[model samples]
Target: MSTDCTTSSASTLTRRSLVLGIPLVAAACVSPGGGPAGPWRAMSYAEMYGPVVEGQYRIPAIDTTTINPAFLRSEVSWTGPEAAGTIVVDPKARYAYLVQPGGKALRYGVGVGREGFAWNGNARVGAKREWPKWFPPKEMIEREPRLEPYREGMDPGIQNPLGARALYLYEGQKDTLYRLHGTNEPKSIGTAASSGCIRLFNQDIIDLYARVEMNAPVVVRA
Candidate 1:
């Protein structure tokens, strides 16, 4: 995707600024639960929402009541070419699926790239970071001079646009500048509002981060 910042503020950069790297993995029949063997039980709204304390950082709980129900995390049937453990993003549907065994996927509502910023292709989760920093791309700074201060990078925290977790996507050895990351703007879920990256709720991202393995495949579909 081309350089574009979703917001004109200095605090965030266009989704094109996010990039990642990792090797590919073969397809496997892994359970959707991603844990002990058993029927996958869905997490209740209360169970999924709350303050998440990771190390010194405390991620505040999301007010699920304000969010659309369709955007909530849940498991759904999936029939895609990707293997289990692969991350499949359906931009038009505004949903992301973490493929699981038995024709199932852990589906999560997401905020996709805005019209002109959309991109699609295969990539891999090259790296992962917690409370990742934010750096406005050079082109973004040129367009919005107010972002000049963040040209170097912004410190990680709740205010950061990347939110609590980030899974960088790469194609072969090249950085695609796209990400499957947590978003500070939870309200943006189920909408096409980002510059190019895919956004998930903080709690959902944290859960996904724990289940996803390094070098997992990611397929973004337009």
Candidate 2:
């Protein structure tokens, strides 16, 4: 099971709240560089809602082996000095860069934490997991009682929150609950969704999962 979905429709912050009765998977990602910037337009409902059953999404099987090539996108940055081999996640733009040896970098779209959940500073990828199991902390379980039933482990399936892969965040040797994971809810990308975890597209996660090794540095910023 994933996170709670108890919020009334009124509490939803989506731009397409007007279009009810259908699962949100049909919405589309707002195309950038448009005439006038307004509320985001989802590229399709599949971006968030996926395939719907009677009313809910019938999520598809997650292909852990194949990375979706569509997610390799780039956004602008201040273009600062490359401190040798380092990865930088520009919080404002919601993009992360894997610094290359020359002046180039491979950029990826990311979903950051909203407002109070935003984090910064230096850390590293302590370890990695393919179809990693999720265990919410004690406080999270307390706040959302529905999470209690999933304490043991969630199977690596389409509905799994970790998506295709997970890069565990850490400081020194301590694990920060925050993770860099792929999301079934692709619309959540380029926006904040969770307390502090960074979400990515399934294809993007699988790509990074293959490139990144243990103890890879990760720098987040405001």
lDDT of 1: 0.71
Tens digits of per-residue lDDT, candidate 2, 46-159, equal 333223221232335233224333443432233557542356787787887766544555567787877776778788988898776776776777887787777776666557
lDDT of each: 0.71, 0.58
Q: With candidate 2 superimposed using the best TM-score fit, by how many Å does residue 218's alpha carbon deviate from the native?
A: 0.7
Candidate 2 TM-score, true structure as reference: 0.66
Candidate 2, run of 10 with poorest lDDT: 31-40
> Compared with the true structure, what per-residue lDDT tens digits does model 1 show for residues 126-202?
98997888776776678768778888887887778788888988899877778888887788889988878898987
Residue 121's lDDT in candidate 1: 94
Name the top lDDT candidate: 1
